[model samples]
Target: MAILSPRRRRSTALTVAAVAGATAAGVCLAVGSASAGTISGPLYRDPSSAVVRWVAANPGDSRAAVIRDKIASQPQARWFANFNISTAQSEAAAYVGAANAAQQIPVLSVYQITNRDCGGASAGGAPDLNQYQTWVSNFSRGLGNQTVIIILETDSLALLTCLNSNEINARNQAISTATRTIKSANPNAKVYLDAGHSTWNSANETANRLRAAGVQYADGFFSNVSNYNSTSSEANFGRAVISALNGMGLSGKRQVIDTSRNGGASGDWCGDDNTDRRIGMYPTTNTGDSNIDAYLWVKPPGEADGCRYTAGSFQPDLAYSLANGVPNPPTTAPPTTAPPTTAPPTTAPPTTAPPTTAPPTTAPPTTAPPTTPPPTGNGCSASVAVNQWNGGFTASVTVTAGSAAINGWTVTITLPSGAAVTGVWNAQASGTSGTVRYTNVGYNGRVGAGQSTNFGFQGTGTGPSTASCAAS
Candidate 1:
């Protein structure tokens, strides 16, 4: 997400100790008045965040209690995305040093670009490549062996299509230069290129942009940075991108997803109210996927998404609703675990390392090999169709429930040799290089007699001509 601090009217609050001492069921009760303390990682907490200032200024406001308990209490990323080059070094040094002293890993969201946000709310960025390089060098200097996760530019990947060839080439060069510079200055620092969100770009398309922008030099790419997509959707998106990247020879890379403010309905990202959004899976490195490194609080909760107040301002009413609207895990759930000293993969390393260049994007294979018909009377059937382009394809699956209603169903298919399922929607899924499985989620699980439900996924491969389906 774009992180711009707009000029806003200030409100007047209680002492930090008083806010810390205030208690609610799921709110954290850390020694400091701020800090939700729900994360199981040593993510740095900015002592001077807008939320903290808001809480201190207006403790007597009706929404103060919930705002303090929810927004201020959680550990979120500190964005150094502004083009304030004059004092950028000192600011980075101070933030890095503070986290180092506190023995925490600082998660930084870096957003300086030549053309940021495409003339939108977060429109300003470095005037040219030289400024960006200078800024990146200064930003990199702060990483003196202290662990840092640099979230490189939010709209970098998704915005490539908007630029002409010259701009695209320049953007890619700047990104490549930045990746090399950061790693050269601090090899220990983890760098993640931003790949927008699931709903914005297909995994195949994002992977292509990320590869062109030098994702190979970085740790991996990040997703759901400023949006409110579901955890599984982002997870699937990452998987697909990683798989496609691997096909491009960037194997063993990883991904991290932003879970902050995704725990609720996650319907219309622009329209969803604060009450509809909850703090998603707590910050942790144990994100159930071998390819995914962490679920982070990238977009700090309570910060307006340009819709409510000016973008990035902390609103008390929004904060209160995000805290009290839905049930989050109690603050007692692991007060604060340190981030991993080494980047740990949640699962075993991938076994397949295929050619990096995807086959030419073209129409699907003309014919399918004849196969046995699906068993009848079991009340289920599966049909698969594929549409392919250079390096990637979208596979659609239609599951027809036969004569009777089924409580739940699972569709399993073998991917074409080099293909990998990167993103899936309308269902939950899991798999390996050759096989993938899709199961119904709550809203779409039950299938009435003779009815069907359609689910589709994007992947990197040529074709999966046919798939076998079974049901009980």
Candidate 2:
């Protein structure tokens, strides 16, 4: 998100004599004070919002609730719930309904249409395009003008060894068909084509796939849907892809990249265990570029794609361990330390008599001086805090500004060596090489002074850590 300039106010009353008197009297008056600010409640910050409340009330697994809360508490963050078609459909309906009730726009992932696992790890989608279209229609029906962001399918465009040309074409066709159907159903909805991040697909290759997949029919393309690449690299790569798409007659088309998981880019095809890739970029508003729309968080924090041993199961203990930077169930030993000692003292001095001098001839009572207000905490300030869980880590942040209520603010998180971002929300992020820049979208307005807004991201990494956040 870009920053807006502050407006200047014109002064009305300015008397030289009054100014002199106030200065001479050493009085201070308040001026340029920021307006009242607000700190969003933890509950309000949850990305899942009312969806979590409803899910909590009607519970099965509390893990979902924990994940939802983590997402909501920050500025740019999101959660990914990988379920079978039946479950995905049901959850999609519930989320849409909840979003409607709260009058809040929600982001939803359409995960069950193709070979969902990219031919590995998890179960695949429908066997054919016809069946996939039906599923797409079903998902669309549930969304009734409720704002939603759809991360179509993950890694579908990936050129895998097992995926033959025919199979790939069939999958790409299904994506194109689904996009067309969804847009026709709900014109207001925002759709993003999953481009498999910078690591999987090169700029030219990804653009061709997007074109073949009929990207023009949708809002734009989506990159890094579920991978762990940083936002900066992704943004640069995405810009390249968008340029390619534009060259292919899809220019001026907007695209969104998932920042949820890629605070840092991976060094190899399969993520390494010795990296500290984490960032604090958030989603941003429409940039008015046809090639890019917004960077978004489409993955949830703390949800494991699959364990080091097991493929795709939710391991809470592992999740917590990774998020908090502990080695599994942490040891119980305390460190040894030395005890403290004593200190020294000092002496006193004598007092002097008060001076009795007639006060200078009373000038007209001096006026008070103008007050110097505290620094404005509101209008566009950001910070990034990183935490480790299981084998992965996440970054939390807050962005604030005066009276200019931030719909959201975008910041880029530079990850430490050997780290990879795995998830994010409230913003769209893209990058590689241990750096992710998050840009906020759907920003409402002026975030008043003194108030701070929060956002976060999650990723996988290894070893000693360091992270930083800055406006993009």
Candidate 3:
């Protein structure tokens, strides 16, 4: 690995800071709510990720519980940027294929800038521009037709002062070439160039570098990768950067902010205190900003950033702090009253063509947001609502007690044929198509009369389908 002196590293960081002071602010955070759905589409779940292994090896450990809920449970990016180049194509294909099978989008970080990190904490990268181009080409080809998000070269735009003019040009050319290669290979894939974060570089400075690197051909840019900047701060930074790019004729570009850590902490980004960083917003597409596409965990929590432990290694202590640091979102609590539920019939709701007018005493068929009330007779009733995207949908089940409180509940649902459950929250959901079962976890077991408990699952399908649900 190429190593630079401490002086040189500090100089590069200082220069980037100087540029940021001139630009990087004034954009507003939209008050709009992101339409409810898994953010960044469904994230690719990598079984080999360090957190997954930690959860698997120590299921009984208390620390594992926090990591599971906070980190392992959420779908995040599967990094292929630092793996063996020779096996990269096949490995990337496997990761992409798995995501497609789950009917979720995969996030791939395209690291390996010619001299990545300017020889700082995370320094190593591809040997040269030519090799880097080849690696990206191979990685892009593996995406197939599945929808994917490509986060290109973290720190490339933010740390440009570390390179000489020739190196900068080469790096820009390499990035431009890689973007073209990835897009040409799969038009459905969304590519995001990295714009560092709000605190690092000014919006105009980063936008200018991104233009030189040819960001127009890709989707947009990303911010706060592996950093602890608040979502509002990064969203403002992204808005400024995109506005700058638009000034230069690059319109329609949007951005994704890395919200993996920033559990509301405001300062000391590089401190060794693990509790200083906490898991941020759960991945969601409802960022409420038109310019901001989604809030994603670009840098999965629990992974250290060169301080408490070696950079990039999964640290358990850090993981605990991130998990327990912030209380779960208020939405996770059970609802006081059952949400207006669309209770389908005891049997599957008709999938055939619907009549223009509703029959007497029957509700209209609902799409996108299932709202039809289910037939309510049993002491327990379940209502399923769905929010769908291209190849996947999130189905939310609200089980309510009618006559008496339910101490423990099991709701069985029939999934649409060919669909697989990718992830579940607030409950233990098992089984495949035909008869999938969801049982309450400890926290949400007791539901008083007229009250509701909410649990959701993500699955692969063209759109939401009527499911037959029974609660016991």
Against the true structure, candidate 3 reaches a TM-score of: 0.61
How does model 2 score by TM-score? Answer: 0.50
* Runs in model 1 lying further than 4 Å from the true structure: 1-41, 266-268, 271-275, 328-472
TM-score result, candidate 1 = 0.63
lDDT of 3 at 466: 46
Best by lDDT: 1
Model 1 worst lDDT window (10 residues): 5-14
lDDT score of residue 320 within candidate 2: 30
Report, for every candidate in turn, its global Cα lDDT versus the true structure.
0.61, 0.43, 0.59
Give Cα distance to truth, residue 250, candidate 1, Å. 1.0
Candidate 3 C-alpha lDDT tens digits along 1-472: 0000100011011000111122112221112234432233445555556776677767678787667666776656655546356866776787788678877677777666766655434556688888887788877778898678888877677655346788888888888889999999998888988675664457897898889998988789987666555566666667788789989999989888776765544222232233544677776555545676666777667765443344456777778877885654333322223112233212111111011100100011122223444344445667665544445544556667666677878887877677767555457777746678888766566767665555556556632344444445
Candidate 3 ranges beyond 4 A from true positions: 1-40, 266-268, 329-472
lDDT of 1 by residue, 155-264 (tens): 66664423568988899989989999989988878888967666556788888899989988988888766555567767776778889988988897888888776666
For each of the candidates, the C-alpha root-mean-square deviation to the true structure, in angstroms, is 12.6, 26.1, 23.8
Better of 1 and 3 by TM-score: 1
TM-scores, each model vs. reference: 0.63, 0.50, 0.61
Per-residue lDDT, model 3, residue 415, is 73
